[model samples]
Target: MLKLFFRHKWGPALLILLLAALVFFYNLGDISLWDPDEPRGAVIAHEMLQRGDWIHLSYNGHPVTDNPALVKPPLYYWSIALFSALQGHVDEFSARLPSALAGITTAILVFFLGARIFGTKTGFLGGLIFISNHMLFEQARSAEIDMTLTFLITAALFLFYHCYHEHYRPGWLYPAYAALGLAVLAKGPVGVIVPLMIAFLYLLARRDLKAIGKIKLPAGLLIILAVASPWFILEGRAFGAEFFFRQNFERFFHAFDHIQPWYYYFVKLPIHFLPWTLLLPAAVAYWFRRRKEKNPGRTFLLIWFIATFVFFSLSQSKRSLYIVPLYPALSLLVAEALERISSEQNLASLLPWIRGGAAFFALLLVTAGGTAAWLAATRFHDLARPVALLVAAALAGAALLYRMIRKGEGRGIVTAFLVCAFGLELLMAGVVYPSIDVKSRSS
Candidate 1:
């Protein structure tokens, strides 16, 4: 069983998703939903199902469009509604299951794209890094649109990458078109806009900006309009063109919600990337140090990462999850860097950076564990010992891994490090989450 799990083609992906599920759904229903976003979304789906009006969405019998803050499109809500049917009710588990699956499938797509462009090893490493991304893990379990949007956008971008290079396969653009439409439905125009921007910049850098023409623009646009237009058309007739302005444009340009400084992502990205953040210095040095190199896949990812960073940095409304859409590209870049470093002889020179990343992670694990216990002490004091024990186990695991790296076990370094990451993530999901949930309720 162990050998087959290791050697089978699709087996690793299932194992990785299984890890993600442990981190996502272990205590999914043990805690109540986060206010405003989670409860609001769950309630909206429940109300929509009760009303049997798929086209129109209502929260507590009120039109979601009536509330500017709640102005999300139908794709996420509809998904939650449909999935909630299994239990004949709406709640965290069912409402959030699609998001969890989307996160899993997004990792699989990363594997395919990476394998197509790089090699199987790079693809597998990249997929592992993505699924273990701290922010992705957090969002995967939550009932929200960001993971769903990130999945759709990543899918569209992956399709475009293939369609651009293999123009003979114009057929790929059809599903890419469908993904873009779903992206728009998932978030808004920005969903479509981010992909378009990425494609434009990537091609421009390649001196083949006209490759967009090969995407079967007429058919692609028709497909997008066909898939995306029906909902908007129904929405327009039901509510007028106000859906466009209120959701997309106003959120982009106006000063109403989630306003943050231009450097918001710059500040938040490190936290979002977490364990992968260690490879960042090497990733940047690898990319820009050989900037003019003709590695199409790496170049595309660099452009995607930079473009996403700058684009979201400049947005008037900035949230950490806005950059969540960019994490796959970031993960691939880190994987590429690690892969490159591993193949080099003097990997010892990079040890300082690796140790630095390890130190940061140790601090994070220690802090997360301590914080969870401290906070829970006031309300759920009984939960504190278990939380402290979990943190100790994580720290012990991390120490053993770091000791191996220090003792020249380079091969196990990456594997050992990733195990610690997985352990910390699982610890958070399984043990610490209930404490945090308790704290959130009190405050």
Candidate 2:
């Protein structure tokens, strides 16, 4: 069975899409729209439909008088409104469908990007890691701009990386620019800025200054302007500089909301990254050890992750999801690290730490499961069934992870970890989140 799957050309990608669909789409509408952001996005999309105005964003059918609705661009709302129109009403599933589809598409993009940079197996692992993580899955299930923005950014980077490797093919760069344009349409300048920064940083790291000319900045900028400028131009004509200067630029330098210390992302990133975070330290060490070598894949990925991390950390306004675009880099890095570590040559050196990390993660799952089960049994009887399902999945997966590591099944070890993590995510989606959603509303 495994041999047949390995031989098939489309097998890994199909598997990834299937798993992503299962996790992202399951119980999608079972919960109500989350307060604040989710409902804000859904309502704006709903109003867009009702008023038949695709350009001007509003809430509750009233024109947004504050500042031209600059908090987020209209693309995401446009997506939601389209989905809602298809479904004949604005419900949670339609509102959130774009994000879910983005998440799935991003997973497939990771597969191709990883394959191009790393190898086929590593690409497969990267795709699985992309979707199974806490941050991606959670965002995929929500009606928010971040996931959509993340997809656009990832798509742009993937195209950029393609152009980079294909000797800066002029034709390939156009789609990348278009993606960035849509990204800007989705969330504003940050979308364009983030990809450009990463590309510039990657080139700088490579010491390939001359390659900059081949990127055709003039043509690319025109494409971006052609796709992105129309909306911004109209927006400026209507509302002037307040939306552009204040909402896009000023918020970064001096945040009026969600202000946090510089180290905010440093603390939350680990929780957001979840099970994969356990292997991150070793992955960083692995890259550092190979830093002197001429490895563009690792070099680009390291810069991609670190540069984005520093960028978000430096922002005066901070949110954990702001850094979602960088998560794909981490996934690819971890996948490459695992591929290397799973080999017999490196397995002995890294196996102990990997085993310990696995054991500790499993212990966390067991503990969290037990606590949730106890709470469900005592204080929240409504959550009893879901809690039992979560606990059972956790316990069973934890045991499997421990056993797989204990047996020292090198390649199987990586497979085991992915399976266990994916199972946990499935249970979390199908049972845990909906249960908590119900409990929260009742409380």
Candidate 3:
């Protein structure tokens, strides 16, 4: 039993269990809606439940006046509203459950895609890193559109890769296109724009423009139009010209509400990626070193990462979560780098460097855990000290798991699985649940 549980194929199943446990733990307390965004998103879904007015989104018994009509699609809210209908009230669990599920699904898809593109070890490592990411973990517990957009956009990229490289079936591209369309509904044009930019640049770089001709663009367009048209049509009918001008066009060219300089994402990327950002230089170095290789998968992933970065960097408005879709591509590249480090005889000398990087990350995790404990003790002194201690212990445990990876003494499969599960369980049971309780009471 122990042997079978440690097998490579078991990694994904373990990841699923870890995600489920996290979601369950995060929602154990009385449902709490945090401030502006989460509660606003929840209330919109709640309104959808009460009024049955899916087309016109409202908040606190008033029509939503802030953004353009259909600027943010109704798909996420609709999912939450549907779940709320089943439960009778839109609680934190019901509100953020879809994002949590999507986050897990994204990890699973990354595993499959990585394994298909590289190898099982690479896939496992990539998936582990993805699930362990702080941004993804935080997003999973929040009622935000970014997580949903990440899932859809990643799924679209997966489909696009398969359809372009392996399947070559016209039918397969529909899902890719539909996923993009749904992504647009989830966020906006950035969803469709990012993928298209990546695909185009990838083909261009590979001089595979001829392959683009094989894509049956008419069918893809029809599929996209079908999936994306309903909301636009509804919003147009409901809000008239304002929907088209403000939501459709203005947000892109001009900043409507929260606008920042174009360089905002450049500065934000490092902080958003956190410890993982440290590895990006290594990943990019490996990418350039292998650019001459005729591997389609590597080329595709490289283009995906570059195109996503360029696309977001050029945009007038910027948010950290906007780059979530690029994570899979970046992770795949990092996995490729790690694989080269593990396999190349000459590169074996870099093992110390790899271990050193892991140690650095572990130190960061420990520091963060200590800081969290300090904050909890100082601010929430009313709460039991054991809670903060437990949270700290969990974070330390995650760091220790990374330490084991640095030692390179255990089975890669087992280490990866345990690390992922431990990280997920720790976040869900320790940080997430307690944070929810703290935020709830404070609110």
Query: Local distance difference test, per candidate?
Result: 0.78, 0.83, 0.71
On residues 256-305, what C-alpha lDDT tens digit does candidate 3 reach at each position? 65577878877877676655565555556566666777888887887887
Query: Which residue pairs in model 3 clash with each other?
Result: none
For TM-score, candidate 1 versus 2, the one ahead is 2
- lDDT tens readout by residue for model 1, 190-302: 88888889988988988986777777878987888888889877876544456577555776788578999888888899877877786577666666656777899988888
RMSD of each: 2.6, 1.8, 3.6
Q: Which of the numbered candidates is closest to the native, going by highest lDDT?
A: 2
Pick the TM-score winner. Answer: 2
Better of 1 and 3 by lDDT: 1
What is candidate 2's local distance difference test score? 0.83
Q: Considering only N, C-alpha and C atoms within 3 Å, which residue pairs clash in candidate 2? A: none
> What's the count of clashing pairs in each model shown?
0, 0, 0
Segments in model 1 whose C-alpha atoms lie over 4 Å from true places: 1-9, 237-240, 346-348, 363-380, 438-443
- On lDDT, the stronger of 2 and 3 is 2
